[model samples]
Target: MISKWFDERLELQKFKDKFLNKAFPVHPTFLLGEVALFSFVTLVLSGIFLGLLYEPSTGKISLFGAMVPAAYASVVKIDLLPLGVIVRRIHHWSAMIMIASVIAHLARVYFTSAYRKPREINWLIGLGLLGITLGAAFTGYLLPYSQFSVTATSIAYYISKSVPWVGDWIARLLFAGEFPAHATVPRFFFLHVMVIPAVLVSLVGLHMLVLIKQKHTEPGANRKRKEARGGQRLIGIPVWPEQSYISVSLFFFLLFVVVLMATYIPLNPIETFGPPSPVTPVMRPDWYFLPIYGFLKLIPGDLSISIAGAKIGPEAIGGVFFPGILAFILVAIPFLDRASEAHNYIENPLHRPFMTSAGIAVAAFLFMTTVSGYIDVLHIAPASMAIYVVVVSAAAWVISYLLLRRYGRAVKKGEHVES
Candidate 1:
């Protein structure tokens, strides 16, 4: 009776036909999106527990007969709470995994040419999600109020102020005065706990709606099947039971793995770093930000340009302009590789040697720059690192292109190829 009444009012059959029975491809790469989704859910749940106990302020507070920053004191209390250690670890690992899965998902989509035609908007949305995820990580890093995190974030403070005309205004707005000021923690706390999360959740919803409308991109084999059928019907398990079961199982497995990692792996022990101090520690930013850090290091410190009464410095060049260019290229990709008609089939990267080689080259540059980011700790020379970056990236492009072309030729001659 409850089902019948709901069905009558909600038009349940139409809803089922639109969503519940939609096709879901059975591919392992497709699971990366689910991993990101589940990890974000885990982050939210764990963040709630942390938020309840956290005091987001830098003002002095009595802790164990000594005064410390309220933000640091609260984190210390959280550490003493039962299961707090594990919960914090879970949150950290979930963020790490969430970022990793999103990057992997984006790479899969790129290599397969899944951003073509109608799906371009979704691609941009995915990029927006990544930017917000990084922002979340950055803000959360400062909540511990440790020396390491403060020093690292201060790098960002200067970078923000490196923008030509409005640098000072934007830096003051973002950091709420000289960073590490009384208001800085509360501002970041608001963004981390409330504003950013709201935006992220809304974007995720829009991403899903776009996905449902455009439908998931499938393997090249699916195109052959569709052509044979003389219609655009997708071939996959229905969303109602089969895909639902798979999704549920995947979520549980991911949860288990995250918990296991939390149990075994340690992260961000605030006590070691202690409270924020004027004496900066020799530390590096997280892995995701390493490329930017490296790029910053690569640029000459004396480099500066003046235009329209605005001074542009090395910090702006490396931190703002370089990253902006990369982002612009990513946003412009679908337009650059435009298709006249709706193209749903996955393209084999091996069949498109130029594009694949370009990806490999970019990956090489990023990897080498990341290595250069650790030059101070690694005791490596800057000139040597720059030489390595150029040499390795060019070599990667050449080798990958030649190998892919040879593979294409072999396939034309009826020789079987693997991977």
Candidate 2:
């Protein structure tokens, strides 16, 4: 009687029948997202561990009665704790993997044309994730308050201050005052720990949900065949064996990279510019952002506009506003390309070649600009005329190609085809 009552209450037979009949398929490339997920998981775990030992407050505190100096000393304590160094290394390495994996995933999607049709929103979400990743990295760099961090923050300050009307206001909001203040570290700590992570987690969830709903976009030809086959679900292997294998491989690879970087190319602690000082001109941002930094510096000082009794520099418009707009455009690409004939790169080369070439050209230009910035920072004055020539040549080439495409399209339509 008791057994029957329990079975009726729990619906045991239905549960067992459903559980025992589920099928699983193993797909090789599907493991890429798994690797990224693993890295994010590692980041969260390590972050929690670090938070427990970290004092986020900017208030003065003594460590072991030694009068540990504010933000720097707290990080030092994190280093000196048992297995603290390893934990920190793991956190840093996991962050690198997360960024790398996200880039790789996006590249895979682009090359495979997985962003076509019903999956466009997922593409936008992925772009959001990229932006969040960059924001997290930037804020994380400030947490350490080392020489590199200070230099990077100084560069950030200048860029922020270059904004049109609210630039100075934004800079003050970020740093909590002029330059380095007691509130700076705490603000960054709040952003890195709570705000950005929450947003990142939400976006990641949205991306995954959309991906699952749409299913993975197979190669276009394969998709056609599958449709012809009366919608038979393609087999995918279980997450255990296939995904586990790839995840393990990626873990070891990242481990090797972390060890190599930590041992051979340890993160440089900027010693020259002690603390945040405006007198020292030696300052530069992190490498990922150097391209934009160089662009700002390249803008001429004379390009200014007077509006509302305030003078605005071209650096404000071109460097900050233009780049920010470009970023928005990039995120909206899937929506902008409204063609339905074909979506894969090979099939729609004519439609997307300009976009593809433009992307490559922009990457090349940014890389060169970054190198120029580094040269300037190192006291080796870069040739301004040479840089200008390169920039103009690239812009001219892109413009010419676009005009040729426009004329070619008009001519093709003008001449009626014999069909």
Candidate 3:
């Protein structure tokens, strides 16, 4: 009755037929994107709740029968509210899950060569999503306004200002007067709650629109369906009942798992960390940012280069150029690889030996840097850091070489050809 009523006035049936009956391929690897999408949705819902009780001010306020910084005090008050602790922790864990899921989904796209020609624009959009997500996380990281947050923010400020030419200007723009001051919190709060979220939400909508319009890529193994004039034939169930049920089930399952995490392991106990200060603490940044932080630490602070009377140090080397080069490489993948144009059809990684091996090598370096981030926090000796650097790098390249050799022989024998 309700459906008929709505359909009569709103013509809802046309929209339902357009999207609900759409074909959707069912594959575990393909589901990674859905995981990321649901995680972001969870983040948004929990974030709105947190924003209601959160204060962006750095001023002291009397709350819960005690005096404390406005940011910290509001958080404490929120925790006292119904399901407040669970909601806040859910937000934190949701961000972590969102980042990890996106990275894995991107890796799947890369190994399967799904980012070719028609998908290049999507690839760019995905990269933008990653940047916005990270920026949102970083800005949120500082909103706690704890001692640990202040310390990490100061280190980041120094790194920004360490660049030779425009470092100082960048740092000044980021924080108006100086580090650990009242001015910075509101700026971060604005970016975290308003600017970054707006951009991210818009991009995510556009990404979904593009995906729906272009149609999904299907596994080459499914040869039963004939190819369309411009795209591959997708053989799967309609989204109306089949795909929608699974997606909704997955969303609730994810929510359950996150709730369990929030119940068991609460994130960032603000009282223990205390308020913001100049004193450096033993704590580190969130795990996702650890690699970049570790990279900056690995370089010698004393190392410097003179450029027109300005002295730039190792921060620019490990912090600037290295990361910039890596980012450029990722963005340049479609143009650099001569065979990217042929990556339209989805195929198993075994079919692309060289590309697969090269990707593995890249993963190794990222893993090495991520572990390196924990050197100081974990109290590893400097000698061990040096040794691990050499060994991890060499081992990555060696493994890639071995994979290539084995696959090369297989290709020569005409054993496994890509569809």
Candidate 4:
């Protein structure tokens, strides 16, 4: 009855034919984007439930017959609920999966050279989503208000203070006063539960709208262009059923995996870590942040440069400048890589030597840096750390160079034979 009523007034069939039933490219690689979107949906549902019981205040309160910070106590209370722990676990696992899938999605876009011409804005949107994901994770981590959370946050605070003249100002703004001020929890709470999520949703909607307007770029989109214009049509399933089924399947699969992990493999046990304190525990960010964390450890803590009395330290290098450069390069790819001639068709990795080599080198560096972050926690010797760093750098460069050189010759030979 509802469907008929809406269809009569709104011409629902027309809308469905025009948009809902649009064809989408079918491929395993394309599933990464769907994974990210569905995980976000799960996050929103779980976040709403958790938010109902979570007290954002950091003020002291009683928990389990002992006094604890309100934030910690609230979290404990929630955990004690029949399924609170599982829900929280699901939220955490969802965030992890979202981050991983987003990374995988971006990598697919990059390696395939899909971020070209008309798709540039979508690429920028993808970058925004990545930034927002990191923000959400950082803020959410503090809600536990455990010793590890506080300690890890302090590292973030100091990293912020590593900026130039405005470093101190930025840190002050973030904490709302000195570190662990009364306003700290509230600020993060609002951003985590409201502001950041709102922005992410807006960007995500815009990304989808843009994608639909531009249509999805597939591996051989270029080859099919002429046929498409001649009304030959493309190969794929409609979004209403076939595509929808695939998306629904991935959603359930991700949920099951996260729930299974939550049941067996535990994470972030604050019951043991206890509340915040003067002494910071061994601080480490999630795996995604490990690269930056590892890089920061390599530079001396007090290392700095004076620019007209503005102090730029090792934090500026690892936290600010390094990431800044990488982001700039990523955003500039559409313009940098044959902008005048670039097309939506994704060329094979071997056919684009420079892009392939650069991607490999960058990914290799981050992987090695993550290894370094873990190695530091084990109290490895300075000699060993140096050796590891050198070996990683050499291996990355050597492998990338060899692949490019070998592929370049093969490509040239093929072109010569064709001519």
Best by lDDT: 1
Per-residue CA lDDT of model 4 for 1-419, tens digit only, reads 99999999999999998987787776668889989999999999999999999999988887767878999999888889998898888999899999999999999999888898878999999999999999999988888999988887777888888787888999989877767788989999999999999999999999999998888876575466647677634456799888888888888998889889888777888887888877767767888888888877666667788899988888898888767787898888877875675465666777676777778878887887777776656787645775777777667767877887897898899999999
Candidate 1 or 4, higher lDDT?
1
Q: Give the lowest summed-lDDT range of ten residues in model 3.
A: 223-232
- Candidate 2 RMSD computed on C-alpha atoms after optimal superposition onto the true structure: 6.3
> lDDT of each prediction vs. the true structure?
0.89, 0.66, 0.81, 0.84
Q: What is the alpha-carbon RMSD of candidate 3 to the true structure?
A: 2.9
Better of 3 and 4 by TM-score: 4
RMSD of 1: 2.4
What is the Cα-based lDDT of residue 39 in candidate 3? 93
Best by TM-score: 1
The candidate with the higher TM-score, 1 or 2, is 1
lDDT for each residue of candidate 1 in 1-419, tens digit (9 for 90 to 100) = 99899999999989998789999876668889889999999999999999999999888999999888988999898888888989989999999999999988888888888899989999999999999999999999999888877887888899999988999999999999977578888999999999999999999999999999889888888878878998878888999999999989989999999999999988888899988766876677878888999988888878899999998989999999988888898899899989999987778888989888888898898899999898888887887888888999999999999999998898877654453
RMSD of each: 2.4, 6.3, 2.9, 2.4
Clashing pairs in 3: none
lDDT of 2 by residue, 1-419 (tens): 88788879998767656442332333344456666777777788888997777765545556566543356556777777786766777777777777767876776665445676767788888888988987888888777665567667766776678787788899899877766677778888899999999999999899877765555554335556666887766444333555456567877776666655545543434233333334545566656666676666655678788888656776676567756976887677777765575342223333344655565565566666666666555554445733763775487558756865886687677775632
lDDT of 4 at 365: 76
Total clashing pairs in model 2: 4
Q: C-alpha displacement of 280 in model 2, angstroms?
A: 4.0
Candidate 3's TM-score reads 0.91
TM-scores of the candidates in the order shown: 0.95, 0.75, 0.91, 0.93
Off by over 4 Å in 2: 1-35, 57-68, 177-179, 224-232, 235-241, 248-260, 268-283, 307-310, 314-319, 341-352, 377-419
